[model samples]
Target: MDPVARQTLLAAMDAGWADPRRLYAEASTARRLLDQAREVLAQGLGVRPSEVAFAPDGPTAVRWAMEGLLHAARRRGARTVASAVEHSAVLAPGRHRATTAGDPSLFVEVPVQPSGALDLPAWNAALQVPGTVAAALQQANGEVGTMQPLEDAWDACRRAGVPLVVDAQACLGRTGAPTSYDVLAGDAQSWAGPGGLGILVVPEGTRWALPGPPDPDGALSGPTRHTPWVPLALAAAEAWQQTGATLDADAREATALVDALRAAAAALPDTEVVGDPVDRLPHIVTFSALYADGEAIVREFDRRGFAVASGSACTASTLEPSHVLAAMGALTHGNVRVTLPLLRVAGGRSEDVARFAEAIPAVVAAVRAEVGAPRW
Candidate 1:
């Protein structure tokens, strides 16, 4: 998180630690701060403050938005469509809904290009299905850094009379939020703010409903309806405001680093850089090594003083290969996902990027040799 955001949170934690739903003085102050945060988020998203709903985090907000849209669409039919490359949070609801509806295919998965681009044609076709109600296509992918054709996807959903929920967690502060989405979801932590703050934008008159019973005002209610913590929300707004002010320069610098990393990864033996080389996120890059394990590679890098993530089972309980890698038909093993900070305030620096790049090939090769993996 940005230092400013961090300090703001620390300060808020001290002063705004009251129940915002209550009518006390402390609660009133907390409510005002929370409202101010919501206003900032709404302005950034080009929506009204009334349209924004705060959740515990991004995934929860996504679940709420998805369930709401899907439930609202039940009148038309209980079917929805999404890109195969969507985050698990976006896919989980449809799967759960499908299970409850007694049909495994209640959710249709649209194929994506090897470059990680969404298959607009397939998405449109899925929308034409008799029971289709809402569709989900992420603004940009978190794993592969691929930017989806959102305008085109939104157009298709519009033509089919289906509401589109865009998971904008990856693109909100990095590239600015897209203006075309009917329902937008994002996370505070993604923009150098504290976690536990999820941003949900529900445009006025959007065809969406909560999965459960309605509240006193006829608004949809979920399992939890308590307002978010005042400080976290305020810090998120402050961080987002800062990100917006410096995004252009930060993006250029981060993109240069990513470009360099991409070139280095592509040049490495038995390695393939995944996602679009040019049309990807400015701060994230992923690559896979042949004949090596992703966890092994991540460990090797960590030992060498660089923190990186892998596409393979990150923990002992989850041994499944990344669905995102599988969707792109890329090597799932020996995968490394590197995400750099977007600004100096967030510890983003060219020196760190250079250090990581310089250490990559050696660490990867060392891991490969330890595993007795063959080089291509």
Candidate 2:
């Protein structure tokens, strides 16, 4: 999170510490802030405040969206369809639902291109399947920074008479939300807001419903049990506000940084840049270095004061390849994922990229040498 937004959240906590569901004066104040936060996010996303619902976090929002839409679709004897590259949050619920229901075929997983973009033909074909009830596809992949074809996916779902849930967790405040979407899920943390807050948009007449058991009010809605934490909501709103007017500049700056990283891959032997090089999230770049283990590379970067991440299973004790990288047909070993801070992007700076470009080659070389692997 950025310093300004961090302070905003701290200030909100001071004022919104009270329960917003109550009727007391203090509660009323909290309620107002909560509603204002919701309105702010709604305005940013081009939706009605009434259509916005709160989730405790992004994964919960994904689950709620998948379950609610699938349940509604099941009323029409429809099943679930999603991309094979969706985050575990989107994939897990359907697996669990199918396991409990004793039918493994309740869900259909669409394949994707090696670029991490969904195969348009496969996506459309999946939706056209007679019983496809709910279709889930992300606006972009968080791990690889690949952007999906939202408009085409939306069109296919519309033709199939299915509700499409677009997971905007990676692109929400940082990029414009797609108008073609029926349901959208976003994470506050993606926009430098408090970690636990998530936003779910169920636009009017979308036909979503909670899976089982209704609350006393005769409705099941967002993942939260009671009123959402007002402070986090306010913080999320403030963070979203901070993104205004700077989105384009940030995109340009971050894209340049990512492009620089892509260029560096050529200088570093046994390394390959992953994702759709041109059509990707601006702030993220991922690459894999052969022979070096993911965990060791991450540690080396950390020791050099560069906080980078890796998707390769080699980092974990279990040593499983990243599902995302596997789906993209990319190398899974010695992977590194770098996400630039929002401030750097907003400021139109590339000094951070220069530092990374210098550090990465040395770091990878050292790790490979230590591992007794072939060198460039």
Candidate 3:
């Protein structure tokens, strides 16, 4: 979190600790702060405040968004369509729904191009697959940073009368909020806000319903499953304001740094830099080195005072091969992913990225050598 956002969070913790559901004076104050926070987020997202709802976190919001649509359209169809590279949050529930229904066809996994961009023709055909109730596509790929063709995808969904649930979790703070989704989901942490806060926006007339049992207060009809913590909401709102104030400048710096990193990785022997170089996220870069171990590469970077990610972007803890890379036909092993922090955050300067770039070649060589992989 940025220093100012952290300070705001600390201040809000003291000022908005009361439960807003109560009718007491302190509760009223807390309620006011929560409402103000909602409005701020709505304005930042370019949506109506009434359309915004909070979730426990980003993945939950995504699950709710997709599940809600599927639940509402149960009679119409059980089928759901999503790109193969969608975050595990979207794909896991999708596969579960299909598995539980005893029909694999209930989930349609569309393929992507080598650049990590969706195959538009395949996406269009999939949407037309008779029973698709909802379709999900991230605004950008989190692991490889490839931006999807949202407008084209949304148009196809519209033609097929399927609701589009966009997991904007990766692009919300970095690339700006998306305007083409029927339901939008994002994480607060993406924008330098504290974690545990997820943003869900269901525009009016979106035809969505809560997937589970009704809220005791009949509040499940709203966007959120539960009331968000007032302090976290306020802190998120502050972070949004701070990020929005500096979004363009921060993106330019990140873009340059990522470009440098990408160039360095691409120059290394048998290493493939993934994602669309020109149409991708400004701050994320991923590269795969043949015959090297992803975990070993991560350890080397960590020892060099630079933290990095490896394996699947979502399933890294399990050391699973990246479905994103697999779908893109890229190398799945020895992958390193970097997501630069927001400029206002610590370790986000140009010098930090430069140092990392300078170490990439040696790190890859050292890892490959240890594994007895021949140099090109």
Best by TM-score: 3
Candidate 2 versus the native: TM-score?
Answer: 0.93
- Which has the greatest lDDT? 3
Which pairs of residues have clashing backbones in candidate 1? 294-334
Clashing pairs in 2: none
CA lDDT, every model vs. true structure:
0.83, 0.82, 0.89
lDDT of 1 by residue, 1-376 (tens): 8787888889899778887767999987887788788788878877877788878898888777788787777667888899999888878777887889899878998999999999888888989988788888888899999999999999998999889999988877788688878888888878888888887888878877675555553222122353677888889998988888888888998899999999988888888999988888898999998877787787788887788887865422478888999999998888999988766464647888888889988887887888898543
Error of 1 at 4 (Å): 0.6
Clashing pairs in 3: none
lDDT of 2 at 16: 83
Off by over 4 Å in 2: 212-226, 344-349
TM-score of 1: 0.95
Lowest-sum lDDT 10-residue window in model 1? 217-226
Runs of candidate 3 with Cα error greater than 4 angstroms are 212-221, 312-319
CA shift of 305, model 3, Å: 0.5
Could you tell me the lDDT of residue 268 within candidate 2?
A: 86
Off by over 4 Å in 1: 213-226, 313-316, 346-348
